[model samples]
Target: MTQVRVESPLATLSPELSAQKLLSRGQAVGGVVVIATVVLLLTLSATVGFGPSVLWYGQFAVAAVTVVYVAVIAFKLAMVFRADGSPVLRFEPDDLHAIPDQDLARYTILVPLYREASVLPYLVERLSALDYPADKVQILLLIEEDDTETRAALASMELATQFEVVLIPDSPPKTKPKACNVGLSRATGEFCVIYDAEDRPDADQLRKAVLAFRLLPDRVVCVQAELHYWNPWTNWLTRCFAAEYATNFSLSLRGLDRHRLAIPLGGTSNHFRTDALRELGGWDQYNVTEDADLGIRIARRGWDVRMMVSVTEEEANSRLGNWVRQRSRWIKGYIQTWLVHSRHPVRVWRELGTKRAVAMHLTLGFSTFTTLINPIFWALFVSYLITGPKYLEPLFPPLSLYAGLATMVLGNVMMCYCLMNGCMERGLHRAVRAMLTVPLYWGLMSVAAYKAVFQLLRPSKRHFWELTEHGLVSHEA
Candidate 1:
């Protein structure tokens, strides 16, 4: 006997499918704009040269800048390698045990959610399973008041008694930092940590952090746990994203801490001393990258932020469009942070000391410049290739060209080494694949960089939060 099965109406028209279609349309538009801009720039560079000599001069200038930028990055990498002679912190298998019942401290875990209903269940389960005492931990699910759907979802959860929901009042410049501030006001813990909705932090992440804090002195005001992704194999985009983060958090940040420079706070699993944070007025609402901005402020005020050896796992954006949106926001925030700090450079130097101030600028300021100006280099390169020596003569002579090429090659080698080191540290099985995607990763970054520049120019036009979807990994499995 044959039976006919009927499909549910809602199953035929899934909301997830609809949202993905909308996202794809937006991404297509963005890609078109980027392609158009690149074409226009290349055409202008080729045709607008006043004369052969002038064209060569412009090319020379571009080559010189590129060479200098690469050289600086290479130098920084060398310094980082030399400074990290030994591990500043270390963790062992036993460190994964639950926090001692007698020694548990009141810890606040703040998770700021905005239109994140899809991943809320996974986030809740991850938090509930942490190897910390349920009674000692206070998990605040910070949600914007306008996000009623997410709010209702939280209400439906049979959450532990320790879990609570805090609604952020609608305010101008609606941002994550503001939501964190609302959570901060209601927090009643000795220590606090920030986690995003997609985080699947190690069960003992908090336990390890607590132990480190107790061992260190009171001056250590914040502890940043190492963050890595669990789904690097999802696609090339995810692989590259994992590599980039591994280098940034694992190598660059740890090196900065070794040199006693201001280490920018990463977005998640950053445990803080509640008193210290409250004293600084929580996070700066105006700074788009509030985590980085707050880290610097704490350092300048004579507090220290340390790095925990423990690692937290999170999802990497697997889709190209999602990756671009996430990267654009990061670049935009970096630009905002740079402007805010550079407004009074001399004063900042005096407060943070010359060495620290220079380090901060080199890392943050140089990062922003490198990303924003990357497309210019590509444009000039394409023009030079098309027009041959006629277009290249004005930029640089043969000797300078050789020097530029050498510097670029050396810089890339160094970056590759750093990325490989990150992959090995995180136990990534496909390190070679991550290395191969470096160029594609850079191309995506170029697209995001242009978008970020546009956003910076008309900051008022940037309002919507391009939230990256999570829940790609299942906890039960």
Candidate 2:
């Protein structure tokens, strides 16, 4: 019901675009109650026989958690192979040019910023250089009203007529989605797309997107392009990042699109039909990772999101601290989105059906829960090494013990293999050696995941966006 119904011609004219609560009253209260119950149980266990309590808890939590994660990883393994075999559309620049000027749709590009003044020059340069028809494209530089520094920097530049600074009124939540909502309200285009300040997308990305929308059925409403870390050779962190992106954008996402599963749209380079976006109430202002939320929402509204082959080059967070902050925010938002949608589990399952509902959990739910509980599993591993499998014995009987052992060993190996295959497919040679040491990176992610869980539990900081600093590395795209 959120998206514009295909049968409803006046859907675009009637706007239900408004910023709403981050979570429903029922959902928020239910979450708080669940957390309180867990705390109380833990406290009670401290007074009770700790061994008995720990045995049952560890048995269910550790074994079940790892097994579920392995299943999800198995799905990803299939996606890696499926993506390799799938074909993508390729068009020469002349093909786009051949389409008459008036036939092309007017495109609106929205880039929301807080304190990104440093990258404004390069951003303008990259955006202005897009090969899309100049007259048909409008770029909205959505800036926060209170961010005087960025606004001043933007003012200093002599931007083209297409580039306009759309100042968003100061508001709570103050997330990128909030700024994006303001820009969306004033957007005048047949289609709209989002870009990060440091992104340098393929010049023909827009044309490719338009072609996708044209060729696909009415139900296909959004298209996400391939995202790549342009400066992957910058550092160890960036190299690992490149491998992750390769797996996610090139392999996993394409597989999702091919199978008609919910595609978690990347933050940038997600092209949407303007009408469909508005019908979904634009972006959830409170969701820090609104792109992912919107992708799921699009599927719920009886629409599908497709993937494009064009690459959108983005800057990698080279600094460990900066990378952790960004990763934590994303994990936090995934937690939020999952809670919001799964509030009515039956309704979600009924709406999306079995396959898609499962896809949602394995994607968003998998990332959030696995990262948060990974350290616990690691601790269990250490405990097993020192003592034995007494804690794990209950979950894995004599017959299943070997299988459980294989899961433990194969889980890490599979992930490393996925990273290597994805990296090699993308021609990122540096990541081959880097994958051998990627477990350390995963430990860092666990660090961020813990931070994300703590932040999510804090009601006051639920919407607090830990912005990642871009422009650290600039290389030839």
Candidate of highest TM-score: 2
Model 2, backbone clash pairs (residues 3+ apart or across chains), number: 0
Which lDDT value does model 2 have at 115? 92
lDDT of 2 at 327: 95
Give per-residue lDDT, candidate 2, residue 164: 75
Q: Model 2 TM-score?
A: 0.89
* lDDT by residue for model 1 (139-257), tens: 88887777888977776778888888877766555777777877777778899999999888888888878887877889899999888888887777777778877877777787877
- TM-score against native, each model: 0.83, 0.89
lDDT of 2 by residue, 261-376 (tens): 88888999999999888877778777888888888888887898887778998999999999999999998888777877777788889888899999899888885677767787
> Which 10-residue window in model 2 sums to the lowest lDDT?
1-10
Q: Which runs of model 2 end up more than 4 angstroms from their true locations? A: 1-58, 85-87, 387-401, 475-477
- The global C-alpha lDDT for each of the candidates, from Candidate 1 onward, is 0.73, 0.80
- Which pairs, if any, clash in model 1? 56-393, 56-394, 56-395, 57-394, 57-395, 59-395, 60-395, 60-396
lDDT of 1: 0.73
Best prediction by lDDT: 2
